[model samples]
Target: MASATLFHDVQQILTAEHPDPFRVLGMHTVSLGGELRLVVRTFQPGATAVSVTDEEGAEVAVMECGHEAGFFEAILPRGTSAFPYQLQVTWPEAGEPALMGDAFAFGPQIGEFDLYLMAEGTHLRLWDVLGAHPMTIDGVQGVHFGVWAPGARRVSVVGEFNLWDGRRHPMRLHPAQGVWEIFIPGVQDESLYRYEILPHQGSAFLKSDPLAFTAEVRPATASKVADLTKYEWNDAEWMRSRQEGDWCNRPMSIYEVHPGSWKRVPGEDDRPLTWREMAVDLVDYVADMGFTHVEFLPVMEHPYDPSWGYQVTGYFAPTSRFGGPDDFRYLVDALHQRGIGVILDWVPAHFPKDAFALRRFDGSALYEHADPRQGEHPEWGTLIFNFGRNEVRNFLISNALFWLDEYHADGLRVDAVASMLYLDYSRGPGQWVPNQYGGRENLEAVAFLQQLNTTVRDRHPGALMIAEESTAWPGVTQLAHLGGLGFHLKWNMGWMHDNLSFMSEQAIHRKYHFNLLTFSLMYAFSEKYVLPLSHDEVVHLKGSLMGKMPGDAWQKAANLRLMLGMMWGHPGKKLLFMGGEIGQWGEWNENRSLDWHLLADPLNAGVQRWMRDLNALYKREPAFWETDFSHEGFEWVDFRDVEQSVLSFVRRGGESGHELLFVCNFTPVPRYAYHVGAPSAGRWREVLNSDAEPYGGSNVGNGGVTETVPLAVHGREQALPLTLPPLGILILQRED
Candidate 1:
């Protein structure tokens, strides 16, 4: 080689501006005189001397410093083919010499098929290809790091091993896939890392791995390399049955929890419970409460505690606040083993503007829209995802599958769906861009959601894709092939709003607001629904469920019992927030425990008891859930008793004529001899009475049973005269 060209190469390496370091730095066969020889080259920033050694620890040759900034090179003896080698270096003041493998010597670790699919944005198992994976290549074990930074001029894997220097480990770019990757030998598990991206047009910065499986705790934003395959899962039985079973007709009573506040270490400054602690405490609590499933608020890693994990930074990582990835896996496995399903709140709607996260990643609007009108969420001060971009869509869709496949989550309760559905959501005029067809609907987002649901369900049968959509977007829970959004269930936000509004009013005003109680029936069967009294209703000073009622303390408790009874009897699946069962008086606070001391009072304990009993009855009674989504399962015995603030309905299970009559009295005034139509003319037993003394209610109800007289009422063949308690709900089943 010529001296002038070698000197220029050395100058480029020193300046960290060389785009292709592999060609000049690694072992290469070059022509010397008339013979081909092996030349090994490397750049160590602070080394004074370097030597090359063969696989047998024999010193092959002493390397000469080609540049003052630590460029080293050595020529092997003639007639020798390339062999495995390592570099031994001595620093100016180090106690011992260091030996390490050449990072640039290894070829690209990502396969061609993976690169092709990644570029096409259809790599469903992107987690396998885009994160720090510990692997052994050519009998040498190391960590292979890969990240997509199409807009970056150069990208490097920075971590403690490299002194966080971008020039130390500049990645080899696969321009076909826009992914930069390198295999650093000797790098192993639990290594802290981030990508130092040099953008084509902006300043260089560091960003966390979007596909990290576990992350460091907040206030420290570094991605941790984890081996996720080591966990021994014990939910195989549950998984196999889940795929083959029908979940639609099943009774689903979900207990929504924010685990951080569900319980805390007593006298430990209210420290949140860890995943191991929750596996012991929270799992048993949910099981004992008779809930069929447990839904967690977003468990993904986030920066601000106040966001409660809604604004995600690490989409594939379980937050380290509780424990490692294995700890979360144990939590899910424990729940499934105990016959409880797990659902996660997934947020693909938006992400926070944390400088170290996805915002302006690669110094460009890569994951979000380039324009503020399409990218920014004004109300949340976050950034909306660019649903139109293929890679961005793949990121979200793959993330959804990751939770379901990796964590064994039974379902996803997609949050902020309404915002994603409409382009102008919470926006004033002229603040949003229109789609190609120029409608208010976000056409791209709609397509993304449809594809997401279809792919997830196709890959994992019986896995629920629920939408928390509040708007009247048609066919939210219908099949996508039939022009619907393809969700298995959707939260009945309208029902929650109207029911809570009606129950919050005074007794006299409730009669005037009777429509609020009956209005939801008009659309109850329109889609599969879950009546959610969720965390949203109890947070942000909206007040607790008990606090929302209008009355004295006793009336408040009684009103809460009636509300829960009515909710259970309603023609929809049920979901209640963590503290709702115990009549928590204060709004939910993420930082504090759930006022567990309230259970010491009988009134509060009674509410808890009522919830348990209600869950049992809901699960055991086919009439309540066996045909929930069909109109045939429900019949309005009478809903026109507005003058008395009363409602009556008959719920039927199957062709066997299994039926239960539900009668609710919203007023606090007891009524004697209230005649309600019965489905048949026989003995009707009062199976459940919410007004019973055990439930903190005035014990006025039918004494176990009532006889149906052969008198016509409400188009039925018989009528039963019954005593109705104040603020009461009664479930009566015929004993035929």
Candidate 2:
């Protein structure tokens, strides 16, 4: 090649403007005087002199300064083949000359098949190839870094090893796949790093790795190099049982916990418990409370605490506020060992507008939409993901699987599914764009959700994909092939709203709102459901469950017990937020621990005891959940007694003949003789009564057992004359 052309190439390398750095910066073959010779080049900005050396530290040749900008090059002897080498550099201000392996010496770390899969947006384990991974390549140990930035002019791996200089280790770009990769030898685990991306038309900026397995703690956003393969998981039995168990029929009483405030160390500035601490404290509490699973608010990495983890920045990383990635794994393992499932809240609807994260990545709206109408979330002040884009879809779908695959999460409770389903969600007409068919439905998001559910179901059997959908969108819990979104379970927002509203009404006025209590059963079997009393109901001045009940102190306690009894007896799974079981008076505060002091109050202790007993009873009876989604499992004995503010129902255990009768009394007036239908002639034992003295009720109930009479009532062959408890529910089972 001509000398002038070589000088120009050297200038480009010195300035860090070379699109493909490997062609000029690493060892290569060149023709000189009709003979091919091996050449080595490097660009070290502050170095005074540079030399090439063999693997054994023997100097091959002293390099000449090809340019004044610290660009150095050397030609090896003729017939010298391309081989592994290191750069020995002497700095002007230094102590000893440093000898380090050339970051550009290694070949492509990502295989062609992986590249093809990435471009096609079908890479299920995208994190395996795209993030910083400590690996051995060609008998050398180094960290392989890869990122996707199609619009970037140049991308470099910048970190403490190279003094955070972008020019020192410019990555090799695979033009066809728009992926840049480099293997930096000696970059070990726990090293902090980030990407320096030079966009096509703007100044360069730094971004945390989207696929980072772990990140620096909050207030420090650098992504950390983690070795995720070292943890020895002991949940093999839990995993095997999970795959074989039928979750729909089995009991699932979830204790929803916000890790940040579930408990705090009063002696340590009230800081939240670490993952390891919670593994013992939180796991023991959930197990002793008889909850089947624990659902945590999003544990994914986020910068802002006020958002409560809804606005995610690092999808693949667990938040570092509590502990490291392995610490989180320890928490899950602990839960599994205690016979409890772990469900993580996943947010894919939108991400916060943090410049250091995914926003305007590559100086383009790459992860989100280019148009604000389609990209921005009006209510959240966040950016919605461009689900229509194949790469973006692949990002979110793979993230969902990442938690289940790496962290051993038994399920994911997808957040804000209602927002994803509608293009105009919280928008005022022109503020949003319509689909191609000119409708409000978000077609791309629907397709993405379907694909996400299908992939999770196919890859991990019995792993739940739950939807927090608040709309009447049909078939949310149906199979994907049957034209549904294919979620295993969906939160029943309507039931939660109606029942809470009813429970808040005064006893004298509850008759006017009787439909609110009975309305849920109308559509209870429409889809698989989880009746949730979540954090949403107890935050932002919405009031705690105890505060929402109408009446004086005693009446409030009675109403609270009645509400929980109804939820436990209802035809669905259950989820109750923290602080509810102990009957906290104030709303949930994210900044402080739950009101553990409330347990000292007898009324509050009664509520907690009632909740514990309710879960135990619910799980012990198949009639409560065995056929929850079918009409055959639930039978309303009577719904016409609105004047009395009372209702009766029967839960059946399919053909097993296991049945339980539920009679609810909303008014504070107890009835001495109330007749309820019985499925057969037998001694009906009062198994559980929310108004018992132990639960702070008046203890007004039948005397343990009531034998069925010969007289008919409510279209049944026999009837049971019973004493009804005021503002309480009684669960009775046949003893004959």
Candidate 3:
């Protein structure tokens, strides 16, 4: 038998007699009679021909997708909704059209889902790209709807399509699988949809589906409702460009911002600014900062404040709070035009109940798990996914690919990964489940993560993928073959917590916590890391970064400057949440604009100037850019000074050697003749000085120095000396 072809277009099918309309990712015939359904499939691109078999060795439903050009539509089984299935591509080749991959079971569900819920309403909107191709709704009828109520005897799916009605669309349950579904052709494309889940024992529950892409609400944590197909995308090059791997392994400096807080534009004040308003100002500001990237807090959609967008419901849609989907795409395009990449904060770990996309979808387990342990996240009080369920896995993975494929996102920072990987990551042992082996390992979750990274990387080689896993998990940024969980970078949480704590305490406290300051460097020693003064630190405990400072107002500002200087001194890449750059005095509030008025203040202006100068020096200094990934090129020159509240270090590049000596003084008292350490004795010149009067520092710098003086310690070129003032940082470069 000739291997089944995975795909053949209507043209190919009409012309060739036995032409397979779909490229056979794999193919296998199985006996679908009893508890088992097996099938085999063919492979075209990264597809590993799958063969599902019964106990009698007969094939059931084979899952596969090929890596060929022009094979976009997936041929799905009739009458069954595609909820969960694994889409695996070779890590470096996954993308639209053709990128070889695999699909596995997410329970009995078949297709991937797109849920990101909103706050309320019975109407739900579902959309997929293929939905636009044919302009017809086929096989979408009878899309099941049910609610999971171990406590419920019945569950129904209702929506706005039925006059805010759900009782009319009741879903039946699969006794063995514990799933509920409905065959609904009426809930077609672009329709506002929601499920009126009838709990068996309680009154009919009103909830949002967890699988909505564009919801009617925001933050996705409130009741989920969506107006699907409302936004129109204009950039085709974005999708094409993403598949090229044009944005990987590069130095990434992300400006984390909230759109609503970033700025407001005309026609959008009483009405919040649209994506266009954001694109105009934000693109220019980020470009001016020399930052190569911008990261948005779960901008897709959510309802309430989980503070910093850790809780998400809408997976496919951009937050209505920001703008429509196409409008968001335009913003991404604008960033791309400015040579800045866009990275979204993706939350796949859990979703809030306010989301209606999959809220009791089909009256049983649809987007999430049917069981309590599998569906609910104990620690976060959210809904967790069953990775072992193929349909659910596909739903998540497909969305990852969709953003890169449709929206032009250059990178993604997966939030709360630690929660996703471990059984009881934040909770105690009693909160989660363990693998068959009885250890802490959650094999299914691990496998899902592996597949996610692999598939995402394969699909968008140039786009970046990052993890926010706080646990010292091994191999977070390595290729799978190297036994690593693949990711480009991990947020240096340990450093942020330790450094912020050390800086927050009075100067006396910092001296005793030297190890805390000294040890963070080690975390950077492995894997590419970013020293993020991320939004995480400033908003929650005790207020803004400056608010955490121990001294008087002047001292507070000085220490804040010192902390920033230390950030520039460190070896890893750097990131600063918005407003931090200009010294916003208050904690982040989603409701208000960053206090741009503060920039008008002299002291704050100086802070801004210092930031600019520092960045200029950082960019110009060859030592900061070269061999930043390796350990040998970077070394801590010193950390012992306490009286003057100073810390100094050298950022060295590889053998193409450029030694950058950084001297920082935290105290407000003026200090002179600061002796900074260096590796060689050369005519040292001041490449840049943050203490220059233009940057709000004391007018006490010569602008340049030429000295090749000899040593107090000759082994590494003895003494490299300089002068410093309160809240000062000096960057010195070796003479050529």
Best by lDDT: 2
What's the lDDT of the predicted structure labeled candidate 1?
Answer: 0.90
Model with the higher TM-score, candidate 2 or 3 = 2
Candidate 1 lDDT over 318-362, as tens digits, reads: 999999999999999999999999999999999999999899888
lDDT of 2 by residue, 275-303 (tens): 99999999999999999999999999999
lDDT by residue for model 3 over 325-382, one digit each (tens)?
A: 6678789888887777788889888776653555455456656767767678776677
Model 2, residue 91: what's the lDDT?
93
Ten-residue region with minimum lDDT total, candidate 3: 115-124
Any runs in candidate 1 off by more than 4 Å, and if so which? 1-3
Q: lDDT-based ranking, best first?
A: 2, 1, 3
Better of 1 and 2 by lDDT: 2
Off by over 4 Å in 2: none
Relative to the true structure, candidate 1 has a C-alpha RMSD (angstroms) of 1.3
Question: Which ranges in model 3 have alpha carbons more than 4 Å from their true place?
Answer: 1-191, 195-211, 218-249, 264-271, 305-308, 369-374, 620-622, 640-646, 654-656
